[model samples]
Target: MLDWLTSAALHAFGAPTTWAELLGFASGLLCVYLVVRQHIANWPIGIANNLLLMVAFWHVGLFGDAWLQVVYVGLGAYGWWRWGTGRVEQRVRSTTRAEWWWLAIAGVLLTVALWWYLDRWTESTVPGPDALTTAVSLLATYGQTRRLVESWWLWIAVDVVYVPLYGYKDLWLTALLYLVFLALCVLGLRAWREQLRTAPQGSPAWSMD
Candidate 1:
């Protein structure tokens, strides 16, 4: 079963596309489409996408990204529960100044730390970009769980870097997937901003808590 899943499904961009990559691509596209529509089902679909991409990335020796997929599974579960809890205050909102500061600091620290670790201990040839994208992705996912509108901005940044990065790694299908994610992130940002604009006047649009 593992062999069959990992075997080449087809050729694309001169690279052999595996069944895992194909499945990951489909699920990932659906996950982001659901996210743009503000549907809660994106979380579960994202978890499945993570599992498929983990195998695809590992096969290509993108160890950092492969491990990132494991972390995504945990984050996806938290997001699933958070979105489904029916909390009145869990509406679309801007990130508070403090939250922005914290996320910026975390992004910098995580990128540096992951770069060092991946360069020194891992076989990743593109450790710098791999680490940077991984850190940004984690931050974006965390912000998404809180329903913060800025999460889409971070995703947009990551997707821009990811497209070329994956292509360089010969994972053409995954690179194309990020291209689609780039477009979806833009739509998601606009949709969430509209949600915030039309929210009740007294409701918080920016939350410090």
Candidate 2:
């Protein structure tokens, strides 16, 4: 089974797709799907997906993304704790206008900072774009943990950037996965909007200072 899973027959766009990539792809997809449905299970499954992709990205010398995956592990744990209450459906909340402003500010700053770090400290080729997406993804993950509908919007932006980035690395399978992620982000946004209409409504105003 292991050999079959890793066989060259599992190829995409003329590139071999390893069993690990396939596992990460499926796990990542499922996690996003669950997130869209407002399920708490996405956290653990996303961790699994991130771990698998961490190995894949590191092997390809995308150290920024590899490290991002490791960071995602702890973040996912925090998200799990934040969103996975006994009455989980009740705890889900949306981001406020003020939070969006702060998140955007931080996203830009972190992107610039990470770009500089990756360019100077690492061997990353697409440092600018990689840093941008990675930074936004961090904020997006936090937004999703808080059940913010705008998280899906941020994910849409990140997926658009990630597809070509992965393709440039010849990770065609992962690139295609991001395309699916783009679609899912749209659906998640719509679903979460409807959810906000009925689930629970509260201000997400928290100090960013």
Candidate 1 segments whose C-alpha is farther than 4 A from its true place: 201-209
**lDDT of candidate 2 over 56-100, digit per residue (tens):** 787677888889998899999987886654323353457888998
Residue 6, model 1, lDDT: 91
Model 1 lDDT per residue over 71-109, tens place: 999999998877777553557889999999999999999
Taken over the whole model, the C-alpha lDDT of each candidate is 0.90, 0.81
**Ten-residue region with minimum lDDT total, candidate 1:** 200-209
Reference-based TM-score of each model: 0.94, 0.87
Model number with the top lDDT: 1
- Write out the backbone clash pairs for model 1: none
- Global fold similarity of model 2 (TM-score): 0.87
Cα deviation of 112, candidate 1, in Å: 1.1
Provide the lDDT at 138 for model 2.
94
Q: Which 10 residues in a row give candidate 2 its minimum summed lDDT?
A: 200-209
Superposed model 2: Cα runs more than 4 Å off: 1-9, 86-92, 200-209
